[model samples]
Target: MSERPNYETMYILRPDIAEDEVETHTNKYRDLVIENGGTIIDNQQRGKRRLAYNIGKHREGVYVQLNYSGDGKQVGPLERAMRLSEDVIRYLTVKYEGQHSSLGRSTTPVAPMESSAPRQDRDLVGAAAAIPAASDDD
Candidate 1:
């Protein structure tokens, strides 16, 4: 028997939807996954946020993310439902092979360290000084 693979689906809904309808939409997709033989790992409602660009005259959307595992068969019906629904504006599904993917894990990003040396001094000290300047001679 083949091992089930991990998948994450993120869909955006119309920001104008009611809270109850949002819950209904989330449950419908969750149930669809279960009915199609997929195991749910994580489901997150990321709340309403501004879109990077306008979609169908709207400037924002409701985001929902679903992480699950299955034999890859469940994707079609799930995506089809979103494509046909007026409530959903956009959606994407990504497959992960193993634990390398940081799904379901919360992590705080570390800030980058700043250099101690001054930028002007550092630029003139090494290879920058050895490079010849451009000339107009042909």
Candidate 2:
């Protein structure tokens, strides 16, 4: 089998849309991807959240995140549908390069090195000790 490229599509829907209508749209896109030869990895409804800045007159939007793997042919149709939908305030699909951080993947935290101490103070003290005291004869 060939290696398929992974992609993540995040879209913002109009906040005022009904919950059932949201489900309809979500299922529509999910089926669309499958029909276009893409396999869905994960689909998440991030729920309604306030936008950083107002998009048009709306202060909040329903967020949907879709992750899939395909041969890159499914993007055009998927994005086209989103572009034509009035309920979709914004949409973006990006080709995932490597390990995605925000996909609920657990990552080991990096521990601080044993020598992780402030060096500036030690350097300053050594520099002061190295310098000769000013003589009155000078």
Candidate 3:
């Protein structure tokens, strides 16, 4: 039987590198995942964008997100690659929770998640939940 899948991992890369370098770095990790017997659900390029704060003297970066299904072990090498890669200035990997779906399957492409900026979803939810009830001022 196939091993049970765990969490999803996504990361960003430094844009200052040549475009080819981006492809190389991305491919390397992809191969690593495959070699480790994991299935890659989606490998997405979120494109370049300005950073909210400086990371390793970088003002912007080429963001990438990987939606994968694999054993927990794959997370370490995924992160190790990020650390060793010179073209990647910053990266964060989050584990999806509570019946979460793996991002985009092969047949369908979902919109890339925005990187290097604030996410609106959290704020929107907070705002909606904080609405005050109407009061009888009169």
Candidate 4:
């Protein structure tokens, strides 16, 4: 068996669906991923929000995000299910390239060096000071 790769999926559902039906749809997709040999790390329901533009005449959608680990072959079926579902307005899946922290974020934080003034700013200031001021005699 191939090693499982980390993946994240975000999907938007039709806003007209009831809360209970939304839960059911969410569970259905989760189960589909698990059944296809994926292990879910996290699942988040972002709730209803307005869409950027009209889709199938929908002005709003309910967003859900799922993080999991699975082999490359598993994605096709999962995406197919979403594509065929009438309630799904849009969906996207992304494979993570490198190691991720427990919450799927980068473990290392990039920090800028502490200084009174950055090198570029200091150079600009010095250049301005070097220019001689104009006089009325000239």
Candidate 5:
């Protein structure tokens, strides 16, 4: 029998958003998962907190979490939706293999894992890429 796949995604919503708008944004992500044939295991609200630094000039956010079961193929659509959503300030989805991904999605940092990869845009390019053209009179 093929093994089932489970994944979890955490995202932050705009703190200034109206209550009705919050529900709309939350439902959007939920529907995305449902439409993709994935089961939503849980939807958690972590509440607002002060940002470490300003994000869009906002000091707080409505944090949320989603636990789901889906194959590798489903990850992309969910990610794309999050990216396009102005209401969602940031999102990160990680596959919790073997371990139970039961907790509500929150803004808190997840425990570091060993072999997973980081996104390419997060990397620092070499100095050569950063160096400007050497203008010269010499």
Candidate 6:
């Protein structure tokens, strides 16, 4: 059997939706992922926030993020369901090569580069004297 890859999905829902409905929607998608042979590692609802610009005439949206592990075939059905839902404003899924500690967060730190060569200062006056200047007449 092929190994499942890690994935993260972030979706936006219409802000006008009821609070109870938000939980319902979140649970629905979580169940969808599990039903499609995927494991839900984490899920979060960021609450309603004003959009940078209106989407589908909506000025605000509720952000939802989910992290899971699944095979390639499992993604299509979940995405399709999101697409068909009128409550969903937008959604995106990204597959990651390696494991992540948390959704939208990176734990590793980058190493600094080292240079082998050292810098040296030179006499600009001597270098300038070595080159001859052109005459204006020429």
TM-score of each: 0.72, 0.72, 0.65, 0.71, 0.69, 0.74
RMSD of each: 6.7, 5.7, 10.2, 4.9, 10.5, 6.7
lDDT of 1 by residue, 1-138 (tens): 877888889999999999999999999999999999999988899999999999998899999999899988989999999999999999999987654234554343557999897667665677777998889997
lDDT (CA) for every model shown? 0.89, 0.88, 0.74, 0.87, 0.79, 0.86
Q: Give one digit per residue, the lDDT tens place, for model 5 in 1-138.
A: 776677888888889888778778778888889898888878877778777888887889988888888776678898998898888888899886554534443444568878668655534566557878887878
Compute the lDDT of residue 130 as modeled in candidate 3: 100
TM-score between model 4 and native = 0.71
**Candidate 2, residue 24: lDDT:** 92
- Measured with C-alpha atoms, the lDDT of residue 112 in candidate 1 is 97
Predict model 6's lDDT versus the native. 0.86
The prediction achieving the highest lDDT against the true structure is: 1
What total of clashing residue pairs does each candidate reach?
0, 0, 0, 0, 1, 0
Q: In terms of TM-score, which candidate is stronger, 3 or 6?
A: 6
Tell me the deviation in Å of residue 136 in model 4: 18
Task: Report the poorest 10 consecutive residues by lDDT, candidate 2.
Answer: 99-108
Residues 1-138 of candidate 6: C-alpha lDDT, one tens digit per residue: 767788888999999899999999999999998998889888999889898999989999999998899886668888898999999999999987655675466445557988788754467767888889988995
Query: Which residues of candidate 6, in runs, are more than 4 Å off?
Result: 1-3, 108-138
Residue 79 shift from truth in candidate 5, angstroms? 1.4
TM-score of 6: 0.74
Give the TM-score comparing model 3 with the true structure, all chains together.
0.65
Highest TM-score: which candidate?
6
> Least accurate stretch of 10 residues (summed lDDT) in model 5?
99-108
Predicted candidate 2 versus true structure: per-residue lDDT over 1-138, tens digit per residue: 857878889999999999999999999999999999999988999999999999989999999998888998899999999999999999999886544456534244556878766567888899999999999996
State the displacement of the C-alpha of residue 38, model 6, in Å, after optimal TM-score superposition.
Answer: 0.3
Better of 3 and 5 by TM-score: 5
